[model samples]
Target: MRVFTVAEAKAMIPEVRERADVIIRLRANLAELSLTLNTTGESPAGGGVAEMKALEAHLGEAIGWFNGHGIEVKGIAPLLIDFPAVLDGEDVRLCWLEGDERLAWYHRTELGFAGRRRLA
Candidate 1:
């Protein structure tokens, strides 16, 4: 539940990108696993239900970490993460933005879209 300033959150772009990469790979692997399950009606030797649970845990940890850093955990499919980080000084919204690229035009907690500013 740690709050962050715009600058602090933006500074995390690098780490975020890395985490994003991992998420993408994990998701792809999960899809493959799903297909295997569908075809075989069972997981491979090591790819048991436990592996799926582990992936879920990993995804949850990643999302939770991002949330803690002030970014809203939007849908994992489209990968939409919202920021600006506050809603009346109390983190209110999570995964509630309209578009992915809208981050540039969207507003922070205190400022509406009319007041949206570049992430400097």
Candidate 2:
């Protein structure tokens, strides 16, 4: 898995949201794929690494396509992407808490999710 610094993950939102609709669809599909393949209780059909690679490929494609359209992407950490982003200019980790409706958790790069504070 690839861990990304908070800075890296935030820079990609423009491109990511440019193709946000597509990304949402892909995420759903990927989740289904995971469920199906993970049913064996071992790992996905190709294993965890392969599954992560596939997601990376998909996200990379989306980012590339969007970037081609003039959307600049930065701060996109697949390994650590945990929730919807608010896109302020701070280097904060995006995460979803157990009960938040949308992504309402964030932490400084040095702190990480475990150190996330509420967004109120």
Candidate 3:
């Protein structure tokens, strides 16, 4: 529940984006493995189950990195993340989505991404 200033949150974007990319790639790999399992009705050769486990663990580690930093990871497919911050003396979430060039949106603590308003 740590709160960050806008400058602090913005400074974290590069590392956050890098980790988010790793999660995105791992998720894609996991989805592909799931498709293979579904279509073949059996695990692929070369220890696919173990590979999937490793991927899942790796993904968890990436997500945990964010949580450990007091950042919230909200989605994986499109890589959404939020940083707790104080805006105008009230708590808000500084939101960032994959492909965003910077931390440019935010919403009140009670709202989600749908309520995001561009930073002024």
Candidate 4:
């Protein structure tokens, strides 16, 4: 697991933001497709299965991009991401949600987002 310093994680925000946008959009599309499929009780007439597959693939790739960079994705809808970091000599996560302007929160490794505290 890679651990990043606060500064390092902060610096990565721009790229993260870009990728997060792509993920959010793709997820929305997928959700819409899923709803359509459910309502119709069948795939759309023209390559709906293929479209879903491609969307899934794109989502996976977007997620893989974050994982490859040592960022942990916690949720897709709100785009929760955690950057491994050391705080007061103990490992923790620097948390960033999709709409946040910067990295402003963190939490203990086991506690998750509900345990998040403002970064000091």
After TM-score superposition, what is the CA distance of residue 6 in candidate 1 from its true location, in Å?
3.9
Q: In model 1, what lDDT does residue 66 have?
A: 71
TM-score of each: 0.64, 0.33, 0.93, 0.94
Residue-wise lDDT of candidate 1 within 19-118, one digit each (tens)?
A: 8777777777788877887788787756677788788788778778777766776577756566645544654232223223223334545544345445
* Clash count (model 4, backbone only): 0
Local distance difference test, candidate 1: 0.61
Stretches of model 4 off by over 4 angstroms after superposition = 41-45
* Candidate 1 lDDT score at position 75: 70
lDDT tens readout by residue for model 2, 1-120: 234444554455443444565666666667766776667544545566577568768967865664464333333432223433333665554653322334445766566666778655
The lDDT for every candidate, in the order shown, is: 0.61, 0.53, 0.89, 0.93
Tell me which residue pairs clash in candidate 2.
Answer: 8-75, 8-76, 9-75, 9-76, 10-75, 11-73, 11-74, 11-75, 12-74
Give one digit per residue, the lDDT tens place, for model 3 in 3-40: 98999999999988788788889999899887887687
Best by the lDDT measure: 4
After superposition, candidate 3 runs with Cα above 4 Å error: 42-45
Please give, for residues 11-108, the per-residue lDDT of candidate 4 as tens digits.
99999999999999999989988889778856665657788899999999999999999999999988999999999998899999999999999999
Error of model 4, residue 18, in angstroms: 0.6
